[model samples]
Target chain A: MKHTISVLVENHSGVLSRITGLFSRRGFNIESLAVGPTQDPEVSRITIIADGDEHTVEQIEKQLNKLIEVIKVRTLTKDECFARELMLVKVSCPAEKRSEIMTIAEMTEAKIVDVTLTTVTLEICARYQKLERFIEIVAPYGITELVRTGTIAIQKGSETMDRKK
Target chain B: MKMKACQAMVECLKAENIKVVFGYPGAAICPFYDALMDSGIKHVLVRHEANAGHEASGMARMTGKPAVCVVTSGPGAVNLITAIATAYADSIPIVCITGQVNTDQIGSDVFQEADITGAAEPFVKHSYLVKDPNDIPRVFKEAFYIAGSGRPGPVLIDMPMDVQKAEIDFEYPKKADIRSYKPTLKGNAFQVKRVMAELEKAKKPLICIGGGVFAANAQDEVVKLSHTMNIPVITTMMGISVFSDDDPLFFGMLGSHGVPAANRAVNECDVLFLVGARVGDRAVRTPLALEQTTKILHIDIDPAELGKNIRVDFPLVGDAKNVLTQLLERAKPMQHDEWLAQLESWRVERKFATAKKGTVVPRQFIDKLSRRLPDNTVVVADVGQNQIWTATSFHIGEGGRFMTSGGMGTMGYSLPAAIGAKIADPKRPVIAICGDGSLQMCMMELATAVQNDVRVKLVVMTNKRLGMVRELQTKGYNGRETAVFLDGSPDFIKLAEAYGIRSCRVTDDRSADEAISLLAEYDGIALVEVIVDENEATL
Candidate 1:
């Protein structure tokens, strides 16, 4: 099952390695991860999407809690969280098909970040599936550059993600 | 004052007053090596990283402090897994710091790029990966707090190359913020009153003390409570020195090698007041005897530990010292001179007579050694027969200590742990006594003594076999020995000699006396190898 892990860590060096290390050691595979600064200057929030055993995820959350630099950690399952990913894609399109691709981009509300003769780049931010479907629509345009910020998320309510009874 | 990152790290270590560290350094940890060159901190370089972790765990077990170790990343950190788990299982406080790839190159899969925090997560109480030099001190502070507080266990910190090389203004944070961490300080007063009420109403009241008494630094508190309450105190392996064995109210150790009267008393007692020690398999052999005959009042630091192995009629959570001191304030100090006299009679009926084999028994040798030891002498014992000898026969007078890895019962804890404990309080004499099997497990640590010039006496009873297992077989098995005997034991004297430590081999009573005399006169680490019959069981 897929679960989302939110980590609050001290803003410092090697913090990323620490977080990633936690995933591997606890036997949880990180399918996606997004790290960025939070309102608290000293702290950063890392949102990671992992797939593995329920017990393994529970353990990963605990391992994350052990790091001194990590202030707090919570794991939110797919059913209990609002999650999204951001992607920027550059694609090759014939002059005749440019308008047709633009229509599809409009339908997905993807922004045009860059454009050149025979190439059109669209920036899309949405749920992972939405990004994938948008990519599939644009796949016909001959792919070029594909960059993405892995899944970032927050739980639906005032939940502290401790499932142990 | 500007200092190197490594130097600041060492200063932070010194601030914790951690005098001993167990590790095998490499190119990756060269910065730490440079800082260690002229520092006062004693570093015990083990043959392997796992041994370092094991040694650190041993030290923590002995000192009730968070022991430290350094290992380079990748294989070095990975090598420490089993020992880390040992600390976790036993809740020994240890801080493991490993080298890491530079911050920028960490996920780039640069040279020696291994996820140390990830690898150590499951086996540790906590872990950190420091990418910024600025956070090093902060992480160090938090690591110690987490590892040594709440429930003690191992904590790992992976310092990347840049962080280890980078420097910033440094000052040890005088305090730590652990809003998430709040350990139980005192038990509920009402509950303690209830226990007192029960005690007031009970006829046969018994006390079982665990390692918590020592861990909580409540030795005197426990002794006071036992004597004042007039309850017979039976200690588990970890609870060995909470009260002296010869005290008026002291019942010898309980469990497998327990006095028959103590075990029988466990059956007769109407109320069992267990402080700090859990009712483990060795302490409570069968459910029929322990199930319903006695009302149990369980008190421990960790809430999860209450009723974990056995059911509890009353449970309290907090530091043992606080719990005990508070219990004294509210408890009625019942005078049970009649009950005490009955116990004294039982003691006489089941007194363990020192086997009068012309050959010196291990217990007698340890007793002689203890007598010659100084007032502040610290003795570390290996598990198996040696622990039985130390717990039952050896005496710890005021100002002395008896330390062992009892809860974990890990073999080979003596030598390296002795180095760490001796370093912790150098003025106090430290000696390690081990069985042949356990000494072999961590004997490489004798070199650890030589490397740092730490003086801790190392004594091994060489039976040329796994004597404990063989003894168990004799008691429980049908006389068939399986993988018990060592074809030919290595010369431990020569092994200690390789480490530049003074050593000797003693076989008979005269030689044993000479060995004890030499132990008192020696100025540095000494290895005394005593030859003993494999057939003799510890009890």
Candidate 2:
């Protein structure tokens, strides 16, 4: 099963490397990982999408909690949390196909970020499923380049994951 | 007032109440060594960096405090990796300080430089690389805190040469505030009640003690619980000395090398309460047997250990001492006379035979040594056949301690570890029991012992071969022994004499008793080499 785990860790050098090293050493397959500064500047939130069974996921959570820098860990349930991914894709589009690409982007609510003579770049930010659909629709035009920011997640309601001390 | 970072490092150690250090120095760590000279901390210069780690680990195991080891960059630090891993496996607290190349040379592949922190990441509880001198005090404080805290393990601090040279105002923190690292000390009230309920209903309850019981200093609590409830207690190799062998409720060790009686009891138990034990492969050799017969209630400090290797029925995540204390409070005094009698019958049925008269038996030697040593003696056993012999035969009396590389099974741990244990408390008698193969791995430490006047009795069980591996081949591979025999092993007595240490060699049954007397009477470092039959089976 694929699970999204939210890990809040102290903002310190080498912590990311330590975490990634753990995943690799344990042979846990990491599907996607996105890290960014949290609401507290001194802390960072890492969202990791990993594939594992029940036991493996439990081990991952326990191991993360063991790390000194890590503050909190939560495996976000699908209903209780909202997740989003951002992608910037450049697709090959000639002048004749530019209008058609723009129509598709409009349908997906993706914004045009840049346009060149032979390529059109679109930026899309949505739930994972929506982003996947948008990419699939754009694939017909021939994707020249693609970059994803992975996924960032938060609880659906007002429950905040904060450090106790 | 400002001082060099290296000086501040020494001062920080003093503030942490560290009295001794085991280490090997090199060019990268010269600055720290220079500062150590005036720091007033007793430094035992180890023969090898790996020995330094083992020595520190021994001290930590004996004293229940974080031991310190210092090494230089590259190979110096690399050599300590195995020791660090061993400490991690056994949950022994050790602080390993390694000197690095200058800050500018860090990532440039300069001379004698290596990524010590990177190499140690998997094993260490926590690690730090100091880039600034001002962070020295904080880093040391955090290192000590992390290493000695709950589920204790090794922690490393890699200090760059430039950082050690730079001057800074040293201010050691009174406490480390690691918000994410709070270890649960008390067991949950509801969980304690649940365990009590289980105890009340259990007909044939067994308590399986692991190394965590010793780590939590809950030996007394566990003993009391076992005696009050009339429960049979079996130990993993790591938990060997947690309960005395003579205790009526205490059964022998459990697992692959375990006594047949203990394994049979575990296979028959209705409810097995595992306190501070991980129930690893060695301890639970036949998991299916346990799963089919017993309902396991695992009490451990680390949540990760619960249901890790086996499915735990009742999980209590708390310090062993606290959880055991709570269980004792809520537990009702009960007796299982029938169950106890059945266990006793099993024990009597599978008792080992007495040693034959002609040859020097390893089990007989251990039994003789156990009787000769004082009640408080600390026995450090190296890995291999010697370990199994000592584990099965050595009777640890009250106040006695046994230290070994149970988890990692590292060879060459006993001698230096004995030195460390003796150094920790000079009043207690310490012994290092090693096989010929194991002793040769770190025999140079005899020089360190002589130089420091550390009185650790060293016993070498000489079989002229790697007995354990040879036994494995004999049993599993149709007796085709290869690369197991030591064709030309050195004369250990001469080697000890060359190091200026007193030594003796024992052959035949009569000389073995004489060797024991010599070990008992010796005041400083001494070695006793006992010749044993090479084909003696361990299991």
TM-score of chain B of each: 0.90, 0.97
Model 1 stretches astray by more than 4 angstroms: A1-165, B1-4, B38-44, B54-63, B103-114, B167-171, B287-289, B348-359, B472-478, B497-500
Per-residue lDDT over B229-339 for candidate 2, one digit per residue giving the tens place of the 0 to 100 score = 888999999998888777888888999999877898898899999999998998997676677768889899999999888888889999999999998887668989999
Per-model TM values vs. the true structure: 0.75, 0.95
Candidate 2 Cα misplacement greater than 4 A, ranges: A94-99, A115-118, A163-165, B348-359
Interface residue Cα RMSD of candidate 1 after superposition: 5.1
In candidate 2, chain A reaches a TM of: 0.95
User: Which 10-residue window in model 2 chain A sums to the lowest lDDT?
Assistant: A156-165
lDDT for model 1, please. 0.78
TM-score of chain A of each: 0.89, 0.95
Q: Candidate 1's residue-wise lDDT over B1-539, tens digit each? A: 56678888998899999877889887678788789778988677787787788778767766788999999877887887767887776677999988877778877866767877766666777777776788777889988988887668899888877777877788888877865566778889998888888777778888888877766778888888877777888888778766755577887678877776677677778888888887778778874558588899988887666765677889888888888898888665787676667766777342334544444577778877788877567788887888787777777766667777776677877777677777777788888898899887887677667877889898888777788899777778888888988777678787777778788777767888889987888888898988777777777
